[model samples]
Target: MVAFGFTVANAVAAWFAHYDPVNIGWRLMFAFAAVPALVQLVGFLFLPETPRYLINHGREKEAQEVLHRLYDNDKEWIAYEMGEVAREMRREAILRQESGDEFVLRRVLRTAHVRKALALGCALQMFQQLAGINTILYYTSSIIRSAGVHDKITTIWISCGISTVQAVGTILPLNLIERLGRRTLVLSSLIGVVITLCMMGGAFILINYDSSKINPAQAYIGIDMNSTNTNKELLDLCFGFRNCDECVTSEYCGYCSLKEESSSLPTTFGQCLPVNSENIQHSLYGYCKDSMNNATAYSFTDTSCKTRFTALPIVIMILYISVYSLGMGPIPWVFNAEVYPIWARGTCVALSTFTNWTFNLLMSLTYLSLSQAITKHGAFFLYAGISFIGFIIFYFFVPETRGRRIEEIERLFMSEKEITPERNQRHEKTVSASVI
Candidate 1:
């Protein structure tokens, strides 16, 4: 909430300072934000630490005191809960240290089930990050503007609103998670996401193909749209157009003809053409530079496409919020932390963390290249395809973790048994704890 409030305050302030300069509204908005931030800071200062953590860390006396302060009437029950948590932690820690001789990496790598869990956990993280979700979240406004949204400010605000809705709607899952199984939640969310992504792809296709009707605002390209003669000669003269600079015109003449003739517009035509016919043939591109002058050209406006359900973006945004909340929001931690046996849990968790960072690094370095090489629509389409594959793999392979104790999952992997007496005992022991 603090992060959200801070972001909103910063954006509103910047918007006001840029667009509503006379009113000094930016100052007021930031000043208002300070109130809640200050309140939160103060409130947090007085908040008690979780007794569970304290007990796990061997601060039993402190944990008891905190529990008593938190629940005066339930002190007896809380103490029993804290005792169980401490015992579980001690058992796990001792077993881990004993097996590894120092809780080191060598022991984990030697175990087959542990290695499998680590690999799967790491792969899950890699897949999630590589799906290109963050690129959409962080750059939605720029994406909309690039799509020819006329009122850039409004588009930005709408993006912010959509983000706010996503954040707000995510809290619902925290309430509904226990009621709905984890597999059910994740599967349903992914299915919804597939639908939403396809819709977005269709919208892009709509905008790209029917640009004359949807986003008629033509991109301004350099070079004269009406020039009778191509600028090939000037380009050759300016910089050796041909592979060989044998022509006398290629050398600096008294004045440059290229400067006089070159158009000031931006072109989708990637490179400055050489005088040779080969360069012209190799140009390999086509787009309407003349569309800027077309009267039928449409600009993205809340009012312009109003009757055509221009509101579809907003509706799709709501679906995005719902799908993300149910799927991507919870799946990472749930997958990486819960699927492995206790013996391999730490190793798998570490590998998963590493996988997330590695994939993030790859994405950060390659996003621009991907966007340029395949176009944004193509890149997102690829991501949607990858997500679809992940959805199918998970539906068949991922087990439901909800309402089941971690030790029960451990038994499934290690003992290969279905709810035996030993597994039930392990489950009962694991569930008696209150550790976070």
Candidate 2:
């Protein structure tokens, strides 16, 4: 349900556009998110806890009751499920008996396989955030604006379309995560992510590269700064820029395309005039500045340039979201739940969940700053690099847990590739003896 709530921002924007003209639509959008939160809070009251939780909490009868209800009281299926859960619980009890500690955290850290599972779970969460999912979702409007869309209503509708695609695309994972397996889906998604990120980055690079070819002298020939209270700093920051992209991306600048050169936006190195705060539709200074009479022939844009490359990013955004939804978007949470041993599952999953949000907060806080500092394309490139590294790590580290039981997953973590402490000690001694 949360996956589909992205369109609510557009809904709130629409309401603000129609019923209210106060410009508080953005604040209301945030307030509206609480609506779903409240709904889920109310809805969960009637929802049953998962059978595993009941089984783990020493309520086997409740676990069986849930399985019966879930399975339509199918006796054979319920028995099979009860056996699996009970057997896993019994095995975990035996292991804990031998480990000499009753504490979940200590046991998780001490057991070699649980430790590996915990590490892998945490790493997956970190990589999920590093993929910049939050940046794409949170800054969809800014991204659309940067794609050369200036009309608020048009931008809002386009954003709603993208959000709808994302919300619907989330359904793909539920069907695919089973057949494709956890690692396969994520690796596949990462491949798509790397490719799409590079493509998106290339698109931004093209926008800047094409705009940079325009000669500023030709584009701003008749344009002149205001005669009074002229800002030299603004001149250097916005006017001194050579490209429409550089100007439009700056928070305080608007690109003013010379009327004669408007036909060839690719080469029309437009003037970067200071933005009019009162009315962002026009510039604060120069021939492009707002006027009731004697309107300038120049076209102005604060968010983006009037360029042909506008539609490319929109297409790429849809493609990226589609690819992501089928894999990395939802699989990390599933895999984290599947990997840990029963004895350590709760503690380990909580730790990984904490890591997921911590990194999410970190990325959300830094994405815009990173984009501003590195340029949008450069930021995408950096994320692509991080994703490439993630690809390699996940390939070598994450095990397929689709059909595997918790016990089976625990053993996979302890498979031949895992070097036990005793094995490491022996290997070290052999190396030392060889040196002698």
Candidate 3:
């Protein structure tokens, strides 16, 4: 709520800040962010550890206290609930004993369903990172600049606003998620994302192809991969691309002159064919200057712009945030949590988390390289295509598991050859009776 509120407020502010306050935009952004961090600190002070955590460590008395605090004057009800929970725990322990399934990696890897779940979990994590969310998040200012917002203040404000919207977007589904099935939500979100991305790409293409109403110096330019100057490459790495051609000067006007022309005894008494135009060197005795200076003309432009990102880009940006939050924002974490059988839940969660980090590393490491090699639009387009592919894969192969029990969901992935009606019946009986 805070983040979304901030976004909406900032958007209003941007549309009506009176003066173009692009000068101190970044500092203003940090100031706003600090307010939330301070608020979060205050919130933490009032929050207590959950009863589940207390009970997980067998601190029944503390759990009881928590339940009492939560329910108030319902000590007997709390005690009854705790007893039932304890009985369920004991039943689960007995099941684990009977089934001989240890909550360990070795045991999890031996199960075919668990293995399939792991694959899906890993794949989801990989998809989320490869979508370039973190790269955009971390370098939002640069991304905005590349999109043509040149003024530091404008870029910072836009970045903070976008981030605030993304954070705000998280709450939308949080409120509506239970009402909608997971698969439907994910698919719907992806479709929105596909549209937003295509729009964003169109915006870039429009900016690129349009050649009216702007100074040449203010327009975006292509990076010349065949640039000869090493200095240009280094600068491009730091601040997108700069045309070295822009640095050339008129001083290098077509020629270099040799030193001491005709000064050696006046070129042997001014012989040597008097004055050959192409083969002549002229030198004077006192303070002589070369006829031409070494200079060239270079034309270049920075990719950033303050005036270009008007209302249209802002709308497209918000759409991007909405779509992102709807699907890519939450699914990875949810899938990571749900894709494992209970016995291997911990291991699966860890593996899925590792998969997320691994893909994050890949995206982080490759993002700049890809951007430098293939321009911003191409990079984002590539990500959109990959996301589309992932959407399709999820639509077909991924099971719908909105409100299903984790164990029941696991059976859906079990080896068909090993799972018969008798086996399923026994499995259901074991699960219901709290057999492992």
Candidate 4:
């Protein structure tokens, strides 16, 4: 439900961005988030304190009252639950006393089960980021633009579609987790992610290659290539054209003119003038040099290059987000919380969360730079490779904790051979019998 709400917010923001004239639509979207935050604050004020917290703080009468209210005045269940909570609190106190003032981090590091849990937790978080979901989430507009979507409104709408698919995908795991199990869901999700990322990368590669073929001439004082002669000699002449040393001849040469008085005038192509005139040196194309200052020098002729794969990239992006939302998006945190013992669970989960945020920050900050360093296609290919590696790691090292108690999970991780087929069969039988 929370993920659904978040996607709805993204859709609304995209809608705002589509129609915003001054480009401040994204800012307005962020500003609107305060509405939900304020509502949550007011809601929290009216919520009653939990019975367990009251019991732990020595407010026994309040704890009993809250328990009775929670159980709808069912004295039997309330008494049983209160005893259980008190016993758990006593056990926790004993564990703390045994640690004898040792730092929680140090104690966590010393315990084998806790240490392994922390390692797996951190690795899961890191792998989640390496899957490259943030790349799409943070730069959806730029990515769609690169894929040949020129209209801002179209790009934003496409992004909203991707977010909607992601939200819908999350629903599957809610019902499937207990039946299909964590390991299967995560592995399947990663496989889907790898395949979708490869397809997206391939689509971009085709678009970029076609774009290059259409516009071979570099952005020199932009000259329209379609209007120029196609002969090799003429092409070579245009390529070799240089800034004039002086404004001595009647021949036209690229030169910069003063800033145009009107806002609509083109800036790249200025009026042609002789070499070294007061005009700025702009380009060497004769036509550009001869044209008026406001003339459009060279509008990109390769607008059609992306048309072939325009829908392809968007489809791939939606598929990738859909696959990710299935299990990889939420299961890692679930596993992180469940794997640790109660005494160290909080610290371990905090460290895992820190790892997630750190990697998320790294990916968001470096995505643009990496895309420029290695073309967009290469970046996605690299991410796909990382996801493949993550899948292998999870398959071999991560254990399924479905239907298992924390103590059982700890034991499974502690013993090297505990995940063998024989042990799994025995564990399943035990769980079945317990349920019966």
Candidate 5:
């Protein structure tokens, strides 16, 4: 639901950006997020405390009242539920007394079962960020622009669309978590993420390489090929020959206005070379210096140079977002909560949550710089490689928590000597009666 709310907010922002009535529309969109917090605050005022929490705090009378109200005055069920909660609380208190005043973190680290759980919890959170979903979310607009989408409104809408797809994809795992199991969904999601990232990287590579090759002659003229002192004179001649009004420099090749005006001078400087030119046949554009001192312009013929592969990156991104939302989005939270014993559950999950946000911040902060340093395609390819390594680690070390009791899960990490038969039998009975 949090993810859904964020996606909807972004969609609203995109809609406003498209029609920005007074130029403050984007600000309004950001402000829309605060509405949910206000709503939650109001709703929380009327919310009742859970029966177990009341019981745990020694408010048995209030707990009973709350449970009676919750179960529609079913006295038998409330009694049974209260007994279970009381027994669990007593067991936890006994365990705490036996363990003495040791720090929760120290205990967690010292215990074999909990240490394993902590490792898995931390690792899952780390992999979630390292997989680069946040990178895609934070930089979707920039990525759309890099994919050759030139329209500002179109890029904003496409980003909103991707978020919408992710929100919808999250529903699949909610339904499949019990049926398909965590291991299946997680493994499948990783595979899908790897494939889509590779495809996205390949698409960018193709487009960038093709665009780079379109006009090699104009690109080379001022830099390497025409190394005479007349380089400045040649650059001036190229600039003079350009008809700014008729030439669109933003396109793949700057069309020569002079060629259209008269067929006599068939060739012009910094323009796209002919399709049959030796350099053009070799897919190499000559380099020329533009008015901007450091900028290089490649020569190209006036043919339509845009590739049909322009839409491929967006398509691959949508696939990647959808796959990530399916399992990676929600399973880590569930696993983190379920892996630890009641005494350490809150502390362990908090530590894991902190790890999650820390890595999330790191990823968001470094993504743009990393992309600029290694290229966007390379960054995604790097994420794919990390995801592959993560998949292997998870398969070997992470247990399937579905259909298992918390005690059973903890015991999975313990040896036979560590788990006595009497305790196991007691846990089985507790598991049969207790609510997760």
Candidate 6:
């Protein structure tokens, strides 16, 4: 449901970007953000209060009514559930009293089950970011362009298509979570993530090293290179590079190539020169400039080069988004919400959420610098390595929590004796009846 909003948003923004006059498409997109926010605000007014919230607030009648409907008016089931909630509440109150109202973090740190849950939650959330979803989400167009997309509008639409895949891909999990279970979904997702990242990395490697992309840059091949001595140092800043691939290594230089007829890769000798600050798509002043009056026929780009492997990122992106939506996209949030006891839920989840955002910041901040330092394909390889580790860790550590109650899930993190025989028997019966 959350994904649905942004699914439509990308296409809408594309339309606005293509058609809106006064160049206010971005402003309109920003304004349109409120439409969903307002709709959700109003929708929440009609949402039913859950049994836990109603019971916590002393709305026993409402809680009973909710449980009646949930458990199909089974008096014994309702009684059991109500009693469980009440008992958990009593335990929380007693803990609070015994701890002398210590900080929530301190309490969580002291509880064995919740501490383990906290560690799992934080690790999952951290890897979720370390997988580089944000890097793709925030810079899909840039990546697409690197994959050899030339036109701005085409890049926007392609990015929109990728987001739509992400949004639509989430629907399968909604249906599969109960069937396949959470652990299965997340583990499968991590495995696919690692494989797809490796595929993407390999595609980039191929693009970088293809023989057709090896057009060496001529230091003064273009007619626009003035013979005057005044700009000699400036010329060296760009012309020092020997090849099209290395030309972009210098931040100031843009690669301008004459593409071959049969291939996407540039063939003829190209030149490297200072990129135009005013309009980076072309050279500052050279044969490669976008102006029609230029002497040489050149395709100028500061950011990305033409390559045959362009289709690979698109294909890999779809696969990545599809697998990601099935698990890491939604399950971490789902699992973290249910992992800890009621008393520690808020504090521990907060820490997990903090881990999420901190890692999000870390990934976003480091991506550009990392790409520059190690090159883009190298960074993708590193992310693939991290994702492989995530797959291994999740397979061993993350438990299957389908149809399990919070107390049962809590028991998963504790020793066997902590689960009373009576409670275990009841839980077994419950699980046998409803294997959701």
The better-scoring model by TM-score among 1 and 5 is: 5
lDDT of 3: 0.60
RMSD of 2: 7.4
Q: In model 4, state the lDDT of residue 297.
A: 37
Q: What root-mean-square deviation over C-alphas does model 6 reach?
A: 5.7
List TM-score per model, in order: 0.64, 0.79, 0.67, 0.75, 0.75, 0.79
| Residue-by-residue lDDT tens digits, candidate 1, 289-345 | 222342112111111111233455456656765677776666776777777766566
Instruction: Name the candidate, 2 or 3, with the larger TM-score value.
Output: 2
Each prediction's total of clashing residue pairs, residues at least 3 apart in sequence or on different chains, is 5, 0, 16, 7, 22, 0
In angstroms, the error of model 3 at 86 is: 1.3
Cα lDDT of candidate 5 equals 0.70
lDDT (CA) per prediction:
0.56, 0.78, 0.60, 0.70, 0.70, 0.78
- Residue 266, model 5: lDDT of 27
Candidate 3 lDDT over 1-436, as tens digits, reads: 5455655555644544434444454356445657767998999998877765677688988888878888895978997777766766666565578567464787778777788888887887887777667776666666665555545557657876787879878978885566776677777877777777677666655554432122233211222335563234332332322221111111111111112333333211110011112322311111111232311111122333223444555577777877878777787778768767666777889998998899888888877667656655577788788878888987886777777887677777887786888877867776667532
For model 2, the stretches where C-alpha displacement exceeds 4 angstroms are 8-12, 19-24, 27-31, 41-103, 212-228, 258-269, 276-279, 290-298, 415-436
**Candidate 1 accuracy as lDDT:** 0.56
**Per-residue C-alpha lDDT of model 6 across residues 1-436, encoded as one tens digit per residue:** 6577666877877777765524687788778889988998999997788887899998999999988888889999998888877776766665566568588888888777778889999999999998888888777887887787877778889989998888889888888888999998899898888888888888877767741333344456544544553366766777665555456645677787664442543356677878877877787656676674643456777767767778988899889888888998989998998888766888888899999999999998888778767767888899999988888888888898899988678898986665778857754654443322
Query: What's every prediction's RMSD, in angstroms?
Result: 10.8, 7.4, 12.9, 9.9, 8.7, 5.7
lDDT of 5 by residue, 1-436 (tens): 7668657866787777766635677678768778988999999998889888997778889998888778999989998888888777776766677579999899999888888889889988999999999988988877777666656677778888888898888887878999988888888888888888888879867765644232334534434445553344443333332232112222222332222334443234434321223332212223322333322223323322344566888899888988888888888998998889888998899999999999999999988678656766788899999999999999898888899977777887777776988877766655554443
Model 6 residue 106 lDDT score: 85
lDDT per residue, candidate 2, 1-436, as tens digits?
6566777666566666553435566667667778878998999998998887898888889888898889999999998887776666566555566566667797778778879888989998988888878788888888888877877767878888888888899888888888878889999999999889898899998888766333556544444545566665776677567788877777888777656634533334357778888888787766677772323567778787666799998999999989988888898889887887555777988999999999989888887778778888998899889999999999998888878765467678785766667855643553343323
By summed lDDT, the worst window of 10 consecutive residues in model 4 runs over 241-250
C-alpha positional error of residue 378 in candidate 3 after TM-score superposition, expressed in Å: 0.9
Which candidate do you rate higher for lDDT, 1 or 5?
A: 5
